[model samples]
Target: MSVSEREKSYEWQVEDARAGQRVDKFVTAQGEWSRSLVQSWIAEKRVTVNARAVKANYRLQRGDRVALRVPPPEHLAVTPEEIPLDIVYEDADIVVVNKPRGMVVHPAPGHHTGTLVHALLAHCGNLSTINGVYRPGIVHRIDKDTSGLLVAAKNDSAHASLASQLSAHTVERSYTAIVHGDMGHERGTVDAPIGRNPNQRQEMAVVRKNGKRAVTHFVVREKFKGYTLVDCRLETGRTHQIRVHMAFIGHPLVGDPKYGPKKNRFSIQGQALHARTLGFTHPRTGEEMTFEAPLPQDMVDILNRLRRESGL
Candidate 1:
């Protein structure tokens, strides 16, 4: 693939404040490019420093001329919809919202509307376009069924900062889940490698080869006669990471459609997993902040039922 013929080129002159910074990283922070995307452009020779093709790591001097050509996004026409959103916090840099169960984060293959992006577009029109046409402000993704607090970047700088924190494994994310079986230990860790399932192409599994390393630390919060409530801490953010890892440990989350048991015990809509706590440094201020969201009504109702019927 190549840059589109109608590439939009951005020009920047490095100032004293940005002198000595790496060219790719400097451009990434300037609100138009992502770090990885900038690096890719540098490799493609679409980025030039001082009228010369330079490496991604090239340091910029004051008044250095930088030109970058980026492909224009497809006019997918993701219209703004005035869907009600559970806004927890909002600022110029970021907005934190509690996504309810059953709402898609962004446009999938065929589906485009009714997603969090659509709502965000209506709520906050100015969103970071780093993620592309569909996922404008999305920094990370929670499953369609798992309800939780998620943060979105309003600008590219904030997006880059948050993405950097996630990559460094410094972001804190915790979840509460009701697993199918009684966990043997009070606390445990599942250290495994997860990759796309070889058998089922749509699913993820603990594949030995070509799998990314994943780890989940769990603590038994409350135990019942047959089920267990556990708090899970994620160290890696792979697709379906918590669900796949918990299932690997023989205690899949209850109501998990793709990974749970076939027999019906709980008439839950989706996985009994809730993202409870999320923590990260502020993109603009560098302040460490954490937020938590309570369990949804469905999960709460099920837990109450379980407590009354089978107390442990």
Candidate 2:
């Protein structure tokens, strides 16, 4: 491989849930590459497990570190669209947007356009390339059905700083969610580890072994007959962390399709969750910053209806 391709190397530590899975399958599950491509890389001895080149069918063991030196991408086009963005804050270093529900943060399979990244390309023109061409300037992501405040870096320095803050667990991120069961207590914390569900590769779950540490502190803001509005603060960000943690505690978000019950009472799409608050330090100025976004109309309407039904 070329030096530039070597510089693009990626690594992932195998968790307990992924133990015994084929190396090619494990690498392909990352969503960045295809199985055939991964197999080709393995044949070329570009993929390694624990510093040793492995075959495509090599079964990964817990704690094994997998590394792959990927070739350059094949002209994946991400066209800039004229989609409107709800700008909450903007400066030379960063742009904060209030992304509405149903709008994807970045492009992926089956969601090529109408994404926040496409809109940002048109609005800002220049963004940090740290996350590569597909997710330029994106530091973090909320699910497609989630609405909230998210920041994007305009330059590499800004992206590095924001990413460091997130890794250090210093960024302040809080969300509002309506859960299915009424909470018996006013506040509590769910401290668990999250990892990919072994049975269902596409889903995340609270796992007892080899999972990354995830903590969520929540307080009941309001309660209805069978639901509770709660505030959730994330200590460590994981994919589907809040949804998985809430469901682990037996109070999954009202409209959550993956983690919650199959049937839902609310007509809203996806989870009844909104990222309401975000705080971080400015990369250039070393200044503290925070932003808040109100709940979307659909969530507000549901709360209002719940209050009326409960006579509260």
lDDT of 2 by residue, 1-312 (tens): 665544477899999999999999888776434355579889999899999998998999999999988767444367889998899999999999999989999999999889999999999988886566788888899999889999999887898788778868999999999998889999999999999999899999988876889999999999999999999999999999999999999999888889989997777998999999999999999999999999999899899999999998
Q: What is the TM-score of each candidate against the true structure?
A: 0.82, 0.79
Instruction: For residues 218-264, write the lDDT of model 1, one tens digit per residue.
Output: 99998877888999999998999999998998998899999988765
TM-score of 2: 0.79
**How far in Å is the alpha carbon of 33 misplaced in model 1?**
4.5
The CA lDDT of each predicted structure is 0.89, 0.89
Which residue pairs collide in model 1, if any? Answer: none
Q: Name the candidate that leads on TM-score.
A: 1
